[model samples]
Target: MTSPHDDPPRRPPVISSPRRAAVSAAAVTAVLVLACAALASAGGPADRRDPTADPAPEAVATSAPLDVAADRLTDQTGLAVTIDALSPAALEPGNRLRLSGQVTNVGRGSWRDAQVYLDIAYDPVTTKGALDDANSSDEPFGTRIVEFGLFDRIGAVPPGTTTSYRLDVPYAELPLSGAAGVHRVGVTVLVTNRDGERVEAARADTVMPLVAASDPTPPPAEVVIVVPVTAPIARHQSGNFLDERIAGAISAGGRLRNLVDLIEAVPPDTLEIVVDPALLDAVQDMSDGYAVTTRQEEADQGSGRNGTGQVEAEEWLADFQTVTARQNLLLMAWGSPDASALASQRMPGVVAAAVRASDEFAVDSGLITPTVSWQKNGASTRRGLVVSRIAGAVIQFVAADNLVNLRAQGESAYLPSLVTVPTEEGELTGVVTARELAGQRLTMSTSVLDFRQNLMAEATIRSLEAASAPSPMVVALPFGWNPGDAAEVDVATAFDLATVEPVDLKAVTQSTPAAYPGPIRLTPAQSPLSDELTDAIVRLRTNGNTFTSLLTDNADAAAFDRRLAVSATSLWLGQPQERLALIRMESRAAAEQLRKVTVTGPTFVALSSRSGRFPLTITNGLQESVTLRVDVRAQNPALRIDPIAELVLEPGQSRDIEVTTRSDSSGLTPVRVRLSTVDGKVFGAPWEFDVRATQIGVAIWVVMGAGSVILVGTVAFRLVRRIRTEGLHPREEPNP
Candidate 1:
């Protein structure tokens, strides 16, 4: 939340444009005429000037140089002044405007009476460019404009002390052009001596549009307001929540709180609130103190640094649940990831995991909404919006929130007023915060001014409707990376003119012919996942192969994979570099944890006998015990191993098991085996061992002797009888 007061008084352009130059030249001529008249008047700012050249009365009385009496008069005269805040976001024509600021006397050199006054002048909005551009200039378009003192109070100040003052001036009294567009106003403090000369001290400028007087009966407006409830893409590092931005948002006076206040001000169905599932997961993790990623350079940072920056959740979840239940909730994909940013290879696994996260959240919160449309940075605008693969699938992902933060996306330059985006799904309405007001830090005056502008937009809508043309105004609340408590009241007042509930996006797309009219399309940059992360995700899926219907039975493995998918969420689209690095770190951690259930046994075993059994070890590194089996296969035909049945390994415990094997030939044989789930799929890495069969077994020798004797007897019997000749004739080919 940035306050407009925080911005220093903007300096006017050194070189005026051609138009301004002409206006300035004319202003010069006008000022000369006005000064001549004022001088002749009985009383004015320069009334009854002392003509004496010695110790000029105006300059000497203020104890400052004569040259600075007009432009910026610094407080070499021992007083410092500042504007703290201004009030009433409902600033309309014929209203009172409050300006709050401070004045301090530092040099204490003055012994007589001292007074503080305010100079406020209006400047009109020149352009629509957001911050960083030369869109705005402080030059007064109307040189006929004059700086007037507002609620100037005469007083005295002690040396080395500060005093606060609030100036309430009637809006109609100010020199206003009264046009409907954006206008800039500047305010500064000055200290005047008894000699009638005033010296400038502190200054600030407020840029906002003034609202025209409201019509007696404004036509009804069809509005849909969508508020973004998002946090930075985050992954729990070492079982701890690390994204501090999320923590701050849910804290008091944070983004979440500000948003909640705005939503609560509206009716339950007034606005649809969209939520990011990844945020919910992290907030839940924060219920207890959790560690976050600190230093990448630290070899084993492990997400915890002795409670250095750990944010244990206090009342965030409680507050969230209470506020969200008050309005409609939409489920954003896990991590609020961008569909376009998904890696081509990880899409299937990633979508499945994201869906699961949403389903699980629904189970926890007892709330769910269809994800018909989503907000993508740089894609969500008044004209062009980003869409993905098939529009139908996207219509299914996020469908549902309340505090409208006036922060803009990607760049701070977008129209802050409500805009209606026509889609095949229907009219998708949202606010593209004005470039000048996007992520604004507003106090009182600017808040009212900004609100009045929004309210004034209703007049524009009404005029079009009166012309027999109806167009709904969809508004989006401004968003900020970090919005402080600057424009706290304006957000709630955004709906003051007439309270109209915004239509739900899901219903709009379903009912309206407004399909996703993607006049423009954008594909995300190719996403990258390190080999280690890929391997870990593969293993996570592979590990579940040992279980039937892994989704229902393998809770632990499923949970771990869910975390990986959330970490890989497209929410990091705005932060590509950071996303890649975090994926690598989380995937590496997953691999380490998956390495727990390992196979341990001898690499070589000698077998002198025909049949023998050898023992092996299966160590469980996980916290929970597992029931599994060993899969064995002999690489050499000379050796055979019996099938293994299901077995169990205790947590942090080792189990020794034996396998039966037999060899008939005298040779060396290689055998391989791996841990397998009950469903019979390999688990950890495979283990192999060599078996040396030194001799032929007695069982083979006995079978060979019997076979030889039987063959010899058969030959003798054939020779004994001619009848045996039939048997020999049988060897001949039969008649066709």
Candidate 2:
């Protein structure tokens, strides 16, 4: 057991490095992608960026028709038209829109002759809801912005090949004259020779800025950057990773590197890191000069002999340890517990597990896991749950305000920053994880792009409103972000323009609370798979005591945790059915391990003498020792058996226990012997046996003799009385 007063962090023992296996190509690619993302996330000189390198415009906000395939048309030879990206999504009035994209001939045959045309159109609708209708409508809007004859030229696009084209149109060349709200940019690909052109092969439209009648909208004043530092690791309830996949992937180059880069890039003072200790804990588990394999067959063999696999761990812990030195919070991430689900179901061990994980990681690392720092996903859980006494103090980060009254329900009043409410479990801290529009893929090619852009621009604009404005606007980076798709430089550019600075989430949440008497508004939580997780956790209760006992041992505890890691919310987010199957499997495994503590003694006890002792044997099949007592139950009082002495069995060991029984009178009695912890929790199943008692004790004989003498004396006295009085009456009756 780790001492609470152990202030200094302990370094795991060192082991020799193992043989270097061949790094797979997939592993290499994963590394490169993470590296590129990291470099891009960190800001560089303006000249360093290539305008044409990743020219895809930030996402556009418009819904597409249900049948997106309708956007493309092909003749005998199939051809496809698409806009890979558009730059400068937000543009000033009269700016020349330089749109570039590609046209592909997807048919088996090549196109000897082809022509491309540029079409520009405008839509009056600007709001996302209205745009969605327009985007999804089968009928196109009649408004035409431009029909240009400038860039229509001959081209030969081969089958399985693409033709790239650029259209540079000045604002004066518009057919719309002076109308503007939002413009639709699209490309029309033509298949024809010099003879003529009529058939259009592909037509794809993307939204872009075309504010002709108005001035350009400036970028936001304050842009908050939230980044997630997380990883995918399946766990064993035994406190271990299902395998070495995490270590192997990370040790080489995997998405995890991007997280390391994110931590490194976050500005120190205001760095808000959401750390799920499950990942860290796995690293810790593997670093013990040992680790389990991800392969089912390998793990089936159980963990290796103590000195095995010592070379496999990544030592990623050192980097994480350094990063955690900055301000951060535990994101209820111990095992990525389904907070909303667990809280709703009122599961006993979930809260306890979270608290235990927090204490283990936080206290040992000298880091903070404030009750207020939990990033619950939705608004449904307005109040705290009444969990068992594990979370000494739990703090929540309500999405809307810095400090909620924790008791009020009126309209909320936003304060300067940080609302920390002290509570029994910890602090009910209120800080928002980034809202949808504020923290997500900055350049996703989807309908929500415009809304996201607006939020980005607004934040930047707000910050520039005043020098002392809420400069460090806080935002939590979305979890499960695809590192390969992140537009780090673009986001950084937006932040730089808005004078936005990276601030640690902890510093923001740790700030002094303002007096906001109003109610705190929170985002509604949407846990579609909550029920499944709740069900899984409920089943885990049956295995709790056994699991707890395992936790008390060194090896068993490690094994248990490795299996439990799979429950981490991030890892199971989109895979509820799979998670359910996993939980069931884990529960079954736990039950199986616990059932190994069985009794191996004789099934029957024959007693010739009234008083005697019987020896019973118990076998422990687990890798951990157990301190337990033998409980004896019998049906007959004649079979008196004392509770056997407490026995402690080492892993995979057995012991014999002797119990004494005394009987005054007995024939056959059913008896049961069961094992329990010293505190009286039944283990496995009880052993039922029959006890046969033959001869009585000497005391029984003595008592019987005394009774016989007393009976004789009473009879003699009665007879005398009868003869003298009553007896004489019987003789007279006879004579009459």
Candidate 3:
């Protein structure tokens, strides 16, 4: 019946009111949550739990000894004594040992001016071999050994003082071959209080094993262990005060001095002297046959005053010399080789050849006082080891140059307060820093006092040498001066002359020249400013125009230099049209090229071209506010030029300037504006701008518009539907 054209006007589709719509949404949401919960329940716990990786392995532990101590000691005289046990002992090859035993003078009367002698032995064998061809039989084992002798004179021990002596002995001297499997090694302690006197009661013993090796490898290298000639931190101090002073004077600041100072500076418990790799090599070479290849001596011949001048001296000389010693011999053989066979055949032949070479070099070099000794303290379980140790006497060479001007000599009253010496810069006085010393050539730098006194000694000396027969050059005393201070001197002129002529004093009356005051001891503050000084100074004002310019150029440098620069130019056009135009044109031209300028205080940089940078520096000269116009124009592409950013700076304030560029044609434009403090000396730091692409903002706007449209449409549709539903349901339905 409804299929007919219009069967009982169909009732309008039922539309829900606001409350009904909300109820329907809640019902749908509840159903979806329940479905999700049912699905989650189906999964297993393992699937929901977090995943974990594998575990790591554990660590293992090992043990090692902590300390090695010398536990025991023994005294043996005459007979070769052996120490069987040393307390807390750990003795191994390559590890050195320090031993101390007291020697008392039991005699009633003090041993006046007596001396004690002790010999340090290494290995078991004593007399090894002969290093000299002239001497067939060498000194016996104990005789050839190194001896440390102690002198007892001043502050002699009273009858009951019982002077106790301690000596340091190395482990290398102990017999080691028999103790290879065992941990202990036998030691012999010998003492002779009075040289050649009756030997003390002998004690021979062995020490407990202190060290053991896990591996059989030999030590990497042989070491030369040096014990302080005295107690720890106290080098040579154990001796008399006078002796200590003498040692300090002779060795101050030298290698020996530095080594002693370093040891004293370190903790006392540390006994070994650990040398750096490079220094170790030098020590080893010296311990071996590398004798001190160079030698010289200072001899003071004579001195006298030259008239009114300071004390003058005569010529000095240095003689060339060398000491003859046995050449270092190296013996090598397989570890498995038969000792007797090798010693008889190869060793003898090798020894003969070495002796021949040693004698030849000695005679050829004119080493008149040649003496020789042989040493063999090392062996190898490896294929073999080479024997290398010095076997020669130290030759004394004569050094007689510059004796009159020596620093030590100057310390005495025999020298005058003001001494004249030829220097590279001329005749100067005072102390000097030694730069080079060889033969007749010696170079030195001026000291604090000497620099002021003879600053131009070098040039003055050269000029005087060029003048006919060195004349009495006038020396000007500068602000500060001191005797023994040194200035560089050029002696090339005297090099050609075999000997220097002694100065002849001109006779003068007592009143002719003022009585010469003796040498003045300078205080910490006041310097003598001796008249014998030669001031070295190049007056820039007096130099040639070209030379002056070259020497004084901002970039040109010598030993020292200082500079100050001030520049001002206007790149921005204003009132001074002509001047402004000129500067602008120049700046524009410079802008075309890559321009980089660093400035202090306010600065400005501008550019309007591609492939170019323009650095601008503007100097302010006006007393009040100053303003200038900066023109920016579009050059290539869709160009963009920024406005002139101002820096509000106090008159004295300085800051860096920045400039940036951009093109709106297509794609993203990246431009940088850099602002930084000059060398970070002032306040502010350098920074750059991070600009985002223009398209990103457009995307945000599109998203906001879509969201607004959807919100309005939803509200309108809901309202219209609610109205229709309300119209249909005149009365409210019963609450469910």
Candidate 4:
């Protein structure tokens, strides 16, 4: 038997010679003859058997007992071990590695005399691929450190109970005598089974990157850490917050607060923060004492309770401004909308509007205008790139894995940070972020130490793999990323390692872009916005434009556009129903505003002559001045009405419009009156009234009188003629 400290066995050497080849042939021939003789003695009807027949039952049963026994041994214990804390994340010569965590009896059975030991793989992981596999793998690596007084022992662990454990072992006791690099470190629990066999009950593994003093250190690699300072969308279109979550988020020990604290801890030039203008705008409003509508009904009714985050908002904003003043900042489009979904749905107008609004906000608030566009959730498409180009973005940030061509090149260990993406509008610089490192920032299952060590290991491996000439790499945090308070320090430490040199994002973008393969490849969006939601957004924007035309002031129109942009944010992706509901709410609010300007008139009117004038009341109920035109028409052909000219109304002002009407005949005629904006969009429902012409015209009277006079004269003439011809009485007596 070999000792665990000994190196793994090596393969034997092969010999190639004519004499050995002849001896091997003779041995093979003799073995074949012996096998044929043995088979003939034990077989029955071998010629009739099919070549594809299954093995015999006895042959299959040979391994079944071993599998059953192994399974039975595994089910004997119910222990679960976890590593909560590790001291000295990096191991050095003569230094001790200490770890502490809890072990719980999750299974039904209890474990007696359970012992916890540290398992270290003496063989260091040399390649980046092997390191990644070790980080994600579950199987234990290396031999257990079974030395006395180097492990923790628990007498008994009953069901549904938990126990604490701590293991401390000196570096010398560990069988680690190889090149310094990342190694697989794990904790295993050994329990006795019913068969008196000590089997592994449970195990937990993590990465341990060893940096010894004797090992040669390489030059640091350039890395760009892009941190996102954003929040989920929660504001209503009417400038009221939908909830008070932002208050907690910016308060002490909150997620946003932790980010600010983290930035303060690190060097100002080492980090790049991507800020969402909408988030800052909301916080500014909160600092000014805003209102929050807790329920949808309350929002629809225009009622809300006063928020209580003025102090927190003020503090956070002040700190944010102070830190960002000395640091590099990149502004995202307003609300950080889902540009990919918009492009896929064929809505570039929304993207353009969002970009414009973000620029305006940045200028007004004394912040940097955004020149780079980032895809939400690190997803991108060809059309998405075009939209970004049209939105005035010079650079586009996308996940590395999304580029199929780059992945197919099989150079993931060290890919250039920048690539040129061709679009219809123009070419854009595409910034590729490390997919694995970016994803690791969002994992919460591992301990902070594990997370920090894994990050260091990944960076170290990259540096080692590209030792010849290391290219710049970008590690962009996921959208809405919130690293907890405890992990903030750990994350900072990970970047401060000797193997990594944090650089500003601008440095990476300024470098020459690598040439990408032809025929760009992009992965389909996993959670794209539905077609119905995008169509509704388009309709909502169209209606918003029409509604804004009623206002004479351009500022109010711009404010409404910002609200529309907020509603189309990426926060709504994969949430079609919720987004549709928000669109409906916004539509109703706009309709309510349009209803403020209306036309009211009398239902019935009397006209003393063929031509007359009546009063139609026009009111502007909005808080701002409006310029509109009044249109009136007669429903009957016998009636004619003159059009009213454009008029301006002040806030809460009412005016009576005099409408002129004329009729050819003396009768009642129906007239309809409507109000429209200067842009020719109808404001509200039409008002109808009946106009009765009471008096006839002088021409009609003259014609009637002349006709009567002629009739009388004719009658008189007829009577005189009848008398001359014969007596009128005689002619009447002959009628039968």
**lDDT string, candidate 3, 488-570, tens digits:** 11212221111112111111011122122122121232121111110100111112111212211312211011000000100
- Model 4, global lDDT: 0.67
**lDDT values for all models:** 0.47, 0.49, 0.23, 0.67
RMSD of 3: 44.2
What are the per-residue Cα lDDT tens digits for candidate 4 across 1-736? 1234423222112211110000011122223333344455677223344657743211100101111112222234545566666666667677789887666664557677677778777777756656755665445467677766776776578765667888988888877755767776767777766686666886765666665542577566687877778776676677777767788778876768767866776665777788877788889989999988744655557677898889999999999988887678888777767777788777787777777877888789776546567766556766776787688765678777677777422445556788877666666678887656512333212233444666677666666665533457787765544444554234566666777677887788787687664344455544666677777787777667667888777576667656776667775464567668777677777788888889999999888877888889999999999888888887777887877889999999999878888777767778888877788877688999888877666898999999999999999999899898887665456568
Off by over 4 Å in 3: 1-69, 74-687, 690-736
Better of 2 and 4 by lDDT: 4
- The TM-score ranking, best first, is 4, 2, 1, 3
* TM-score per candidate, chains pooled: 0.57, 0.59, 0.18, 0.72
Identify the candidate with maximal lDDT: 4
lDDT of 3 at 246: 16
Q: Backbone collision count in every prediction?
A: 46, 62, 42, 0
* lDDT pick, better of 1 and 3: 1
Q: What is the lDDT of residue 250 in candidate 4?
A: 88
> Which structure is stronger by TM-score: 1 or 4?
4
Query: For model 4, what is the alpha-carbon lDDT of residue 398?
Result: 74
Q: Per-residue CA lDDT of candidate 2, range 108-193, in tens?
A: 45565455555555333343333333333222233332243434444677654666666666656644434434444455555664
